[model samples]
Target: MNYGPLLFLGVFLTLASSWCGLVLIPQLQLWKSGGLEAVKLEKTGEFYPPMRSGLAEHGREVYRANGCIYCHSQQVRPKGFGGDFLRNWGQRRSVGRDYLRDKPVMLGTMRTGPDLTNISLRQPSASWHMLHLYNPQITSPGSIMPPFRFLFETRKIRRMRSPDALDLKPPFAPPPGYEVVPKPEAQLLVDYLLSLRAVTPLPETE
Candidate 1:
């Protein structure tokens, strides 16, 4: 006759336990030791530094706004997990520490495009990134990424082209009388992409 009160108590206990296990436990673990464990350096004593440049951070926002995550995954799964290792997306599997400071990690869900975790190392030239962004086909002959031309401008060629103007060749050229110069946003985005690299050798991830 009084089973309703007992049932309510049991439900409350179950919910409390679930919340403690799911939320509290993870928070405690991640924040324990002042979170120093999450940011410890690798065996080589090298640590991946945070984004120091404002342009790079702004570029990250631009990347998110552009929905680059929909087509790309920054993660590199270990050998048994997927082809990420085989494809050389990264030198080693990504670790939690690699993204500890990411705030909102960019480890996307799909691999429509290659992982950009180490793109700065993969192609170190800013010009290449600019060309690719202006029109993917310019750098990658068959890349399906659409050109972000609005991020650039075509202005009449003055006596001297803007120092930041792209060095376009034949087919990728804008026009004889005009030159392609990346606007500030494009420059920042390129800088950000160029800054993405994993230098440390984290064996635990492998």
Candidate 2:
């Protein structure tokens, strides 16, 4: 008795069930739960996961173009899994709806740097972000993250210094009579980084 057909049917059934359980079922559940839509807040009458601004949207492109995703991740692990809550990477566990507005969803796999899920809320200072981008060492001592100095330009100071100029000190600062200022791309990238916030509570994730 040839069991080739029977064996093939069994293997196919097993793979099909695995796919259904792993992928199809979760997708169906998400759709059914209305998890893809923007949630409405009863008090403010505003929606959660607010819409992305034009600058932040452009900044997101800059973030991707600069390959920041390779080192920094945007996902926060749940409790008992990786101690993400203890680390204060996020106020709550990340969920599908948290990424509904993200076009590519930068849930990076590597952890060369800290998770950036709630960076905006954690470090809301734009100047701090500017310095970190210009040179990680200035902000974070002994940081392995490379400086994106090319994003800025050293220009001779005219009548006065530009307000957007990086307030560098000592070796990080440029020579006298000159100041380092972030270009458009650098500002956009910082804007994108400053926009990364996922602290809102969701019914499913909470």
- RMSD in order of candidates: 3.3, 2.6
In each prediction, how many residue pairs overlap at the backbone (N, C-alpha, C within less than 3 A)?
0, 0
* Model 2 per-residue lDDT tens digits across residues 86-150: 89898788888889899898899998999999999889999999999999999999999999999
Q: What is the clash count of model 2? A: 0
> What residue pairs clash in candidate 2, if any at all?
none
**Which runs in model 1 stand beyond 4 Å of their true positions?**
1-20, 33-47
lDDT of each residue in 102-130, candidate 1, tens digit only? 74688998877798988998899999999
Can you give the lDDT of residue 91 in candidate 1? 74
Strongest candidate by lDDT: 2
In model 1, the Cα lDDT at residue 182 comes to: 92
Off by over 4 Å in 2: 1-25
